[model samples]
Target: MTEALGTRTITAAVLVIGDEILSGRTKDKNVGHIAERLTEIGVDLREVRVVPDVEEEIVAALNGLRHRYTYVFTTGGIGPTHDDITADSVAKAFGVSIDVDPRARAMLLEYIAEKDLNEARLRMARIPAGADLIVNEVSKAPGFKIGNVIVMAGVPRIMHAMLEAVLPTLDTGPKMLSETILANAKEGDIAGPLREIAERFPGVSIGSYPFLSETGPNTNLVVRSRDPELLAKAAREVADMVAARQPAA
Candidate 1:
């Protein structure tokens, strides 16, 4: 999708790299975790895609996302197992050489005994050249960052830790601010008036959400913008619109 004109939108895309996720064997947790962290840091999550553990598929997704967005985050398939092909695919994506980095190996040794450091575990240390490490506090194994693409572990805890480590390094634009007004009227009733309010406020985004309770269907008008003043102005209009449509007590 095209970005709105004249807006400073710092966009990001998430590539979920694993077969188990697509097969429904393992549900995704990192996409939401990463998206939440990115939003807090003022990055807009523009797109999300889940690809199987195929090198070509991973490479294609990475290439497309890294160029299209400000940042590309991949979760899963970075473990020691054979299906953990995220690292290798990332290396091939950038056409860079992949080898066991001394820094990553040192971190792994801090948790693994010398005798237990097998070839499979060593695979976790293989990072692409000229890439920085994303620290994983949960496990000694680290993720890697090359260019705008950040590769993270599939495990939710590990991915969350790595995202926190990467957050401070991002270049953020204006933060998205939101104000919500709960309307006693149903969504169907307020949809027409809400559309008028939205057209009146070009710089602000107005959304209507419906939920059911003991009182039946009700609408929530959410106004989002980077400027607080603009958001406030739009929110007031939405509240007024909802009030006008509400039934008299």
Candidate 2:
């Protein structure tokens, strides 16, 4: 669901496809890249799902994400291979026909010669009917955007480029403002105070993240809110809470 503050907040989901990702053979990187970029443009990344190459799984995920969020971004399985079933699965999800888009084929020709575009390589041109192409500056293969679903390549570089091309077409929402306070105390020391602060500021989201460094364990208290004023106030309260617990020196 789209988050609402003062303005309508646009939310999106990243569906990472391919069995390689689940198998640990290929770690998924597009989620973070897409999430950060989308946040910069005021889009909230609501959900992320990684599914295998199974067509049924892809279709089910597509239907769920597309309907749930303002926009759905799917990465992987659009390449030219037998396992690249994202295009066809997406078609079935939307009840549309899949065909070799002339536009996509034309784009591929710019990198691969017409005669050299073999059957496997030519599969890159297959797109769901009535979908627009997302420009791939890194690779000549184009991604497709149909309805609220945007399908892009799995490679981080290529996905990053495609996201850039599609940014202009999206409608963003209110930007989230955040503030971080480094608490010298351990996470356990700050949990009680953090929870109290969270209750005090219902509009602001306060999270306590703990990390172990070479020196010792520390807590990173982060406050986030759509309202900058609220965020600032909550952050100040958090700082005060941390200071109150310190022994007088």
Q: Largest TM-score belongs to which candidate?
A: 2
Clashing pairs in 2: none
Residue-level lDDT tens digits of model 2 in 1-249: 225365898889999999999999998888888888888888899999999999999999999889999999999998888888999999999999988889999999998987899999888998988999887988789998999999999988898889899998899888887889999899998898789889988888888889998899998999888887888899999999988888999
Cα shift from native, residue 77, model 1 (Å):
0.5
lDDT of 1 by residue, 20-59 (tens): 8989999998888887877787899999999999999999
- In terms of lDDT, the best-performing candidate is 2
| Worst ten in a row by lDDT for model 2 | 1-10
The reply for model 2, stretches above 4 Å from the true place, is 1-5, 247-249
